[model samples]
Target: ISPQTCTEGFAYDRRARQCIDVDECRTLPDACRGDMRCVNQNGGYLPEIPADPEPPSYPRVRTTAQCILGYTPAEDGTCNDIDECETNSHHCNPTQVCINTAGGYTCSCTEGYWLIGGQCQDIDECRYGYCQQLCANVPGSYSCSCNPGFILNTDSRTCQDVDECADEPCTHACFNTYGSFMCNCDEGFELAADGTSCIDLDECSFSEFLCQHRCVNTPGSFSCVCPLGYYVFEDGRSCEDINECDTGNNTCTTAQVCFNFQGGHTCLDPLQCHSPYIEVSDNQCMCSAENPACRDKPFTILYRHMDLSSGRSVPADIFQMQATTRYPGAFYIFQIKSGNEGREFYMRQTSNVSATLVLSRPIKGPREVVLDLEMVTVNNVINFRGSSIIRLTIFVSEHPF
Candidate 1:
């Protein structure tokens, strides 16, 4: 028996020992030419008929000659070009474009994209320096941006500085700089930690001598104050004593004279001398030798006045009396003879020539005290004795300070 022979479009299988129908569409490259559809039969292949009927001038006819993949046999017995794009027969990706040619078609990527590995991919355009400050890349395009404290200009590619001070970000003053701003305060105020608010400056706390008497803190400023009996000087920081006698602000009776002192004034009686004593100077008196009453009187009398605040501490030395002349072999003794009725004052002799009047007790005032202080000197070697008196007048004020 001879080997079995297979017909066209059929292949003999050695393993199965039978003839199988061949797939011309997969085996033959030019089996289905152009846009024509192909079908396989038991022993052969046939081309599918066109959807439209053949025209009268171009009638369908059977032919034995074969054509290439992109051409077909027409009724006139000649190969003709086919449009694969028009028939939707081209193999292209969804993102690719199908362009028809005379007999074939091509696939390409759309705008803003490129073809790679049989697929379409987006192109990055931000690699180029197109923005002045910043740039952002999108799928198909790029955008330009600016950094903080800057704005895009009309050109859309350049950046400009923004004026932050125009919005009044500071409480007192504002200054604009390149891409930034600064805040400042007024003359007497200071900038707060927030950089946008103002706070009062405590000028008084900066120095102890800002004011002579007292310092007062105000909003954004400071003021100097003086105590009661004093006035603020023109310099605005020192204190000056108020002259009540010159300003006529003193309260004195008609029988008294107003005398001004450092921080106060006093009302004093006019100096007078009686018969046994004669006035020699404004504050001194001498005894008359011709009068009999002068025999027991002091040799001289001196008038002195002092002003003090009320409630003075005890044992305070208020006044000092010194002899103007010294003599050889002369010793002196001092005493507060008359004003000791209340035991409020005493005398302490520091030396043979000087003595101090001391307050033995506290004295409350708007009151006055007159004390007769006597100093006696004796010289046993010369067999002589002499004495003098000081009529001391004390005026205590009503206030302690």
Candidate 2:
């Protein structure tokens, strides 16, 4: 027998088990399916992934260190971080600061801060930069704070400024002394209005009665305010009335009707009395006529809804309702102001009604909001001598309600 084969191929021996090489390709021609192309290796097989597949997965496939995450041969193939900024997976948090170190990356807060941006970050313990007192570890960096009433020294990370004013242990202006200090209020100085510092004293009285005009006082100071019309003069003690007429701004309505009095200007009303000829008295032009009474044909105003056209519901500030005839009677303007509490006249429509007037009882006291719209008719022009014509005295008064 030969060492290669005993029989035609490898015949089954009774003592030694022997078999021939079977051709799997000739037996199972359709072994691999789809677009996969399989190839046999030493004790395993491999397949080419399909080009049409969106993503491919193979647990049996072998991979190298270069393609794996955090894989580095220099670090004994240990997992290490990739420089996300330089490499691929780099996603910093919003407003967070990202920094990559050897085999890893670190995150820290920006200047003037100690809180994280609320995202992923690695802590750097070896750094000298940290918050002042009590640095607490947060998501990214650390937070700094001072003790109770003590503020951060700012210059040094170890020292703190205790607000002696706030700390009840202090006595008076909290003067910071070395590691600690005490509160203090200076001499001749009471607690400040804000209770923070010492203040001085005012020698004036607090009853607001120092001068004839007015008196004003402040912390360690006092002043006097003169009356509205009076002004502080050269003496600084006595007050004087401000000559409004001297400034050409006197409150006189008519320039010819004003009379400068002792201390103020007087306002005169143009008056009209029932008379054939006018007579000037006090500011009124009184009449002294023989037959000036309207006992025969009187004057009046006519009032009626004539136009029949209603307008918008607005307050009637002023109206001109034409009477039936402009002669004979004249109405006495009695209550010409806001009446019925808040009730105002609304001229939605108007009228042309005739009305004749007669002498009625005179109204005594006036009321609120008296307007100055007055009118009176001239019945007949009579001249006592070569003077002016006769004029009727018309008086208006509001209701007292």
- For each candidate in turn, the TM-score is 0.55, 0.22
RMSD of each: 12.5, 29.3
For model 1, what is the alpha-carbon lDDT of residue 251? 96
- Residues 273-369 of candidate 2 have per-residue lDDT tens digits of 4444243553334333434552332232121111111121233233342233344433322222222233333222232232122222223322222
Index of the highest-lDDT prediction = 1
Please, what's the RMSD in Å of model 1? 12.5
After TM-score superposition, what is the CA distance of residue 31 in candidate 2 from its true location, in Å? Answer: 99
How much is 213 displaced in model 1, in angstroms?
Answer: 1.8
